[model samples]
Target: MSAIEVLAPGLLTTVQDLGREGFGPMGVSPSGAADPLALRMGNRLVGNAEGAATLEMTLLGGTFLFREGGIGALTGSDFGANLDGTAVPRWASFEVKPGQTLRLGPTRSGARCYLCVQGGIAVKSFLGSASTHLLSGLGGHEGRALRKGDVLKIGDAREAKEKGTDHNASSTEGAHKSNRLRSVAAKALELLAPRKVLRVTPGPQSDWFPKAAQRIFYSSTYRVSEEANRMGLRLAGPAIREGAHGEMISEGVSLGAIQVAAGGLPILLFVEQQTTGGYAKMANVISADFSSLGQLRPRDEIRFELVNFESARKLFIEQEKLLAAKDLIV
Candidate 1:
């Protein structure tokens, strides 16, 4: 199949897949979609599987000329994309004709956006995944961002159903449970704004802090600080102190591990987080609410809530069920 020719690469675009798994124990970071939800939903809109390699565009997207006929989807940020000078709707799959010129501008809403083609973007694999480890320079366009004049191959074209015409059908959630959406099923097709409410589970080191510290974490409002990125997000808010607590050896770190630094500042870890950290972790923003977290830009206001592991699991299940039901109609 012909590939998409990069004419004018955007600010920060890279080819990514579902992300490398089972390599965390080896000190290799699980570098995947900073926003897995957008990756999955965008791929679903097209005909690609959840783990397929796609393009991750930062705030500003770029231009590309389709050399082969295919279909694609754009999700997450609204960068005001267009095809051959005609506007293309966000969160929907559209036909990409050969020789067509597609253009994307700087982000207007969310910080990142994903572009999923019918045939996934084919990139070199590292550690068994196509995701790019920016820090270590693994599986991407030579472990770097996409460049102008790059010719990335697209998977061979296969006929897919009329692009999500079916409704009410359930979908698989994170390789585990199946969920069904009950409410707002009617608005599945209607273009709307992002509905974001992030829920979180307690961290492994929650007990390290006192009761008052925990209360402040949940009570004080926070915003995404300017010093945030794929590795971690440094939050700006009340200096949440861990009263009468001392430091310990660094333990396992995950995508949403909330760590309080020496200055009493809080930060949220992301995909490129270190294998271990020594900071005091208070809680973890659960997987279900991670999409919203990924959307946050510098100074974006947000709130936090505490939850148990079981409750967090249940929330994740519920979200997956909702997405499944939307699959039926949208």
Candidate 2:
């Protein structure tokens, strides 16, 4: 079996997939790739399933030694990666010969980067997922961030290939596959670009705030604070006045819920957020803008645009249509 040995683990590197769903009722949050779009694109580029487990690196990147030659792709933010001293481009596929070392530096564009290989990371799954739930420490490789000297098993490349096409496919089919890969890579570069304005819809408790507070929430600019993490992001901005409505029982909170704390600061719930909270939610980020959350870095400036629930649904549908289009990859 082929494997990759970690030489220098970055700030926080973990093995993650799309994450475990339908388990929130059991006190488990979906702790998958922070940037799901990037992971999907990287996996597609390497001819693996979109949800295949891959290495997720935050802020700083690390060095690794590949024990066997294989195909790989670096997606998400630009991390200034290099293979054997040669610069490797992001959002494209490349090959790593046996014994070659790939090194990556601090992120340049976003908060995280993903390294997807021909075969996804092979780790025992928990609750039907290979995602690392940092808070509970119950999934992924040993249920925690990776460290130096850790060796990760690579799934069988033949299986990944079978998931796409037969190894003995006709030359025409092979050519088509090659063209589709390039086209998808080109489209990913455009679709995944970061933006400063996040689209959101009124939260369940939107009516609790006064009209004046509502106006301030949409008009003001917020900066990602140092307290940001996968579980949530504490924004530093003009304090939003506390809602007049009295405290209520704790309820289920969805990802991207903008909850206002007593200090007037808003906390944006993320992929690994707690299932239930009592904070008054001012708004919920639309699904289309979830990827944007992954790109936000500490101290980064951001604003919000209010949209209706219907519009949010339309936006999500459109994005899914574009991503699933056969022409993009065929």
lDDT of each: 0.74, 0.83
Model 2 segments more than 4 A misplaced: 161-188, 244-246
TM-score for each candidate, following the candidate numbering? 0.87, 0.92
lDDT of 1 by residue, 145-256 (tens): 8899998888753422221212213333222211211112235423223434456788877888788887887888888888877788898888877642446687888888
TM-score winner among the candidates? 2
Q: At residue 269, give the lDDT of candidate 2.
A: 97
Q: Report the CA-based lDDT of candidate 1 relative to the real structure.
A: 0.74
Clashes of 2: 0
TM-score of 1: 0.87
All predictions: root-mean-square deviation over Cα?
5.6, 3.7
**Superposed model 1: Cα runs more than 4 Å off:** 159-197, 244-246, 326-329
